[model samples]
Target chain A: MLADGLRRALTLLLRGDPEVLGIAALSIRVALVATLLACLIGVPIGFAIGTTRFRGRRTALTVLNTMLAFPTVLVGLLVWLLLARSGPLGGLGLLYTWWAIVLAEIVLAAPIAAALTAAAVQGIDPRVRRTALTLGAPAWRVHWVVAREVRFALLSAVVVSFGRVLAEVGAAMIVGGNIRHQTRTLTTAVALATSQGDFSLAIALGLVLLALALTVNVLLHMLQGRGDAGAA
Target chain B: MLALRDVTHEYLGRVVADIPALDLPAGTTTALVGPNGSGKSTVLRLLAAVEAPSRGVLELHGRAVRSSAERLHARRAVTLVEQHPLLFDMTVAANLTDALRLRGARRVDGRQISEALELVGAGSLAARPARALSGGEAQRVAIARALLLAPQVLLLDEPLSAADRAAREALGNVLAALRDRGTVVCLSSHVLEEAYRWSSRIFTLVDGRLEGMTPENLFRVDLPPGTGSREVRVGPLRFSIVTDRSGPAIIAVPPEDILVSRTPLDSSALNQFPGRLTAISEDGHGRIRLAVDVGVELITRITPASLSRLELQVGTGVVLSFKAVAVRVF
Candidate 1:
């Protein structure tokens, strides 16, 4: 079966299937939107967690930390329930749409961003905060300085979050329905190709996924190196 | 002026700081002296608004900071240079400009940055990354960051205490200049002599409670002959100036004022302690430092020849004597 699947994937790639290319492009577009949304929402939350010292801060921090390990299928299930027909957001008809896939991916990536950013901020000493405050930096300016200083970590967070969301199959397959020429993404495409015994197509998608993951990891490593150098 | 009216802070439900009505004068350097865990840092934090008072009220220029936002604004008027310089993970220029930016000073000139750096003798370090700085340089940068904001009050939580004498002296001069510029500088030091030299007023924290808010006054003790201060018995080795009045106090005695004798000798010096020798080490010069403990352990620097002539040992006994006149009760 594996040999037959490999032959099918090689032939599909040789044929240069437009449907496969479209699915790949749509996947990238959805993942980009989701990651961008996550960045917007998660950066500020991460900044708050990193810098604030309010009551229940620790509890809030712990919750975010715990959410970092949220399984993709569970996130997909939760989003499914929220956006499903007869669900709270059912009237939006977002299920199996690119928007629904994007929404699910955002949910998958946000906690990663928040958790990483929080750790980055917490790594900073209170003395720096005190220094910033005493320097007459208003609260907002204080947050900005902290965020800028921890930018490398934030970038690494974004990369890791993007990788996590892009590689998630359950959310995309469930929310996007792996629809052809519509909501299919890299992970869902690989799964569908594998199921259909289209091994060449699956192999090509697997390579892309591996490349995407590797690129994110390399970027993360570089950002981390810069962070260490800055700290040093 | 930063004033505290019975400011108290607790940690683990126990009182870490309990200052009773401290009125720190603006445009002068005051040193808070105490042993470890004595709430010295707590006092600075309160003035800086880093920590809220657990019970009593703290007023900056007669206004109470009621909320965190208010405190942030109040804190802007004051800068705290902590014991560990707390350098930001950014360029020196960025760290210096951070406060100005926070104040919304977008057009802050390079001249001002250079001026602040020069004030701290850190002009060359403007481009240096904060994390790459040595301990002393980082402290200077911290000071520069504080001063660039031109804060009304400067709280240094033993900023230079951990540094070498050269660094401490440089920092002291910078602080002295800040105080001269009408900035209220509050410095904490565990070393009394260093604190005495820099602070116009000296306050000592006793057992988590602040005491001795007296202006430094020079007092002389006259010792009788053959009564070397070294021979006098003391309960503890703690150098405590027993004073009658309070506002700020100072003790001044040259090393020459200390008269050491192997045997009990009569002298004009009134204070004497029977010190057990712990370590006899030589100061670079002709001076020798005898680590002695009578009631409290102390290090007394005497002449090298005197050390040898007396045959001082790690376990030997000696009489530590200093004239009452020599012991200036601040």
Candidate 2:
């Protein structure tokens, strides 16, 4: 039975089955949007935390680090409450949609993005800032220069955040409702097919998900290698 | 003038730098000479406005550098090159251009960038990646970046620490040229000869205190009671100066007044000793500086012609003579 399921799964993936392809595309689209949004919101915060000295900086970093490991289901539950009927944001009517999944994924990924970014910025040599400032660069430009210096680390943050949201099932299931041709992602489809004992579809979607992650990481590695060589 | 008034810097409750007062004027170069951990870099940082003094005030052009607006204004005219320079992870040309842009240059002239690199003897490194440059190359690049801004005041912390011989000579020429351009320059070095050669005025820091700027060899000597004149002993050598000052006092001897000879001379000079020539090096100019071990080491400056005429080389035995009146007791 297992052998038959494996053969059927391979055939489905090779044939580019519409249902499987749609789920994979939706998964990538949602994760990409979420990761982009997280980067936009998190990079500056991380830069400020990593480069400046202020009151309560340690506490802020601790909070960010703790948020990095927040359970995705809890994030989904919390986001669900915010978008539920009679909830404060219910008037927007975004629940049970791809937008809702995007929101949950952002919440799941932003902290990781921020914490990793902070670590990367902190890893840069402190003299870089001094040199920039001595050259008459303002405070903001100093941070910007430092960010450019550690571009490789920022790329890693993007890759890690994207992978986190792509493989997340509990949040997308809770908030996205797995609507056919809309909210159903590779991870959710895998969950739904396995529960119904459709092992062939489940295995096919799982393989695609793994392949997507591998492709993204491999591309990033190539880019990072190029950057390293150019720097050298 | 750039001045520090009652400045004291403390790091985590431990005092690191304490300067009662200092005045640095324009169109002159001052050297801060001291050993490691002697708070030389701290003084440079304070002058650069990279850090604020924990106590007292730092003034630039008669305005306090404590406020953000004042500091911003001061930074436009002041630049510092750190001991271990960190260049941006970009091409050397880009580093120069970036600094120019930050200094509010409307157009980053490639000619100017190349000239600045040439000034530091790193013109060939313009296309190389900054991160790939060696320590000496990066140091030159950092100096070039600072020079591109044309700051009115340049502060350097061991600028020649990593420079090669050629780069060091190039930098010395650059500094001399800057003086002619009316830029006030201050640099710190642990090498006393380098400091004495490069700076018209030298401030010696011992345990974070400025020991005044006197163009003389300084030796801390103990003065014990004597029958006629006060006898001051430094190492195995003793000199009787015409002074009544008791206890420990600093003795300053003018380097130019000290004469070196192959034989002991019959003269009125009160101080004479037989010593070995430990080292001979050129003082930035054509003059040669000899490190003679006369009980305590004494630095004597002479022309290269005299050095050759005297036939002095390393380890050559010589007689050093100086008049007691030439010694300034403080």
Candidate 3:
């Protein structure tokens, strides 16, 4: 079975199927855009959660952690409801578009990024932050210093979220409609290929997904190790 | 000059820190000594700008600041070092470079790094990967980094707990030099002896309240051995000393003044005890720490040659004797 799958996957890649290549490219573009958006929104929230001493901080943290476990299909369903015709955001006409998948992925990954960033910042010695503030690290710099100290963790969060976005099928299919050569990602491609009994194509997409995940994990593992060493 | 006016803090509606008023003048090393949970670290945190006083104003050079941003501007002039030296995962040189980056002293800072390292006697380990360095070495690197920042005020929280005697002494000198350079240094420690030795003025914290103690107060003990009309007991294993009179007393010795012998010495040393040895450990130098059991537990430091000659072990019985004159009556 493995030999047959590999042979068929190799044959599809050599053939350079437009649908396959287009879907892979689109997946990369959407996941990157979504991850960047998540970071921009997530880092500040993480910083706020990290340094603030207030009521409901714990509640806010608990909610974010709970959201981390929210399944992909659930996110897809919620976004589908909001962007589908006759829904609240239906007038925007984002349904069945690339942006719909991007929007859904952003929502999916934001909480993961935010919660991990918060954890990383919180792991820093409280005294270190105080020292930075006292030593003239403008309050903004205090946030930055603490954030930078946890940069590796934040990177890992992004990578983990990226991995989730790359592998996410339910949301991309529902929101993007798996549009031919327009919105189909590797995951959507894999699902369509399997449904059509094109097992070779599906296996190829799976290989690419596994490679991407491994690359991210390796890079982040190196960075996190260095950061931990520095911390020691 | 650092001044706190009626600073008060509460957590979950319970007051955890309260100080009526205090001034930490420039260029003096003030040691804040207290037991655990006494708010020593909290006071350092407040001064470090990691915390805000719930009800009081903190004035630095007679300025008023409201937000953490403003406080950070003030903090640039004061640098705080935590009890555990938080070293970055990098080369020692890189960590020192970050400290320089903060002060905008890029060119001349490298030389200052070496100077700071030399002051702490860890100059030889400059190029070492920081993670591979020992606890004491890492602390010295941290001190070097803090000094490179050259803040007008320095706050240290139990910074020498991991250091050996030589390193501690070296770091003590470095701090003294900083004091001489006119840096207002506030240091906290759980050990009173360290505070007594290094601080010209001492502030003690008890149950979240701050109180000042004079230099003499640290040394003030009831019935130190040398003073006239005082009596105390020194037990090697068993607490079997029958004093001339019983009252508040202390068994004081110069530590180095203790003489160890295999046989009962005929010396006129007034205090002596015969005890089985409990443990023998060296402080990595010529000196050895001997825990001997006489009437009561006693610690004796003797030369390595004597230790080897006597062949001390956990069950070895030896005579622990010290001179009365060496004991100073409080």
Each prediction's DockQ against the real complex: 0.46, 0.43, 0.29
Residue B203 local lDDT, model 3:
80
| Candidate 1 local Cα displacement, residue A166, angstroms | 0.6
Question: How much of the true contact map at the interface does candidate 1 reproduce, as a fraction?
Answer: 0.83
Q: Score residue B155 of candidate 1 by CA lDDT.
A: 83
> Between prediction 2 and prediction 3, which has the larger TM-score?
2
Q: Distance (Å) between predicted and true CA of B21, model 1?
A: 0.7
The TM-scores of all predictions, comma-separated, are 0.76, 0.80, 0.74
**The 10-residue segment with the lowest total lDDT in model 1 chain A:** A5-14
lDDT of 2 by residue, B44-157 (tens): 888888788999888999888887778777777899999988887779999899887766677878999999999988899999989888888888898888888889999988
**lDDT for position B40 in model 3:** 85
Across B20-116, the per-residue lDDT of candidate 3 in tens digits comes to 8767887688888776677888788777656778888877887755676677676777777777776655678877776656545547547877887
Residue range A167-221, candidate 2, lDDT tens digits: 9999999999999998999999999999999999999999999898898889779
**CA-only RMSD, every prediction:** 10.8, 9.0, 12.3
TM-score, cand. 1: 0.76
Q: In DockQ terms, which candidate is top?
A: 1
Report every candidate's CA lDDT: 0.76, 0.85, 0.75
* Winning model by TM-score: 2
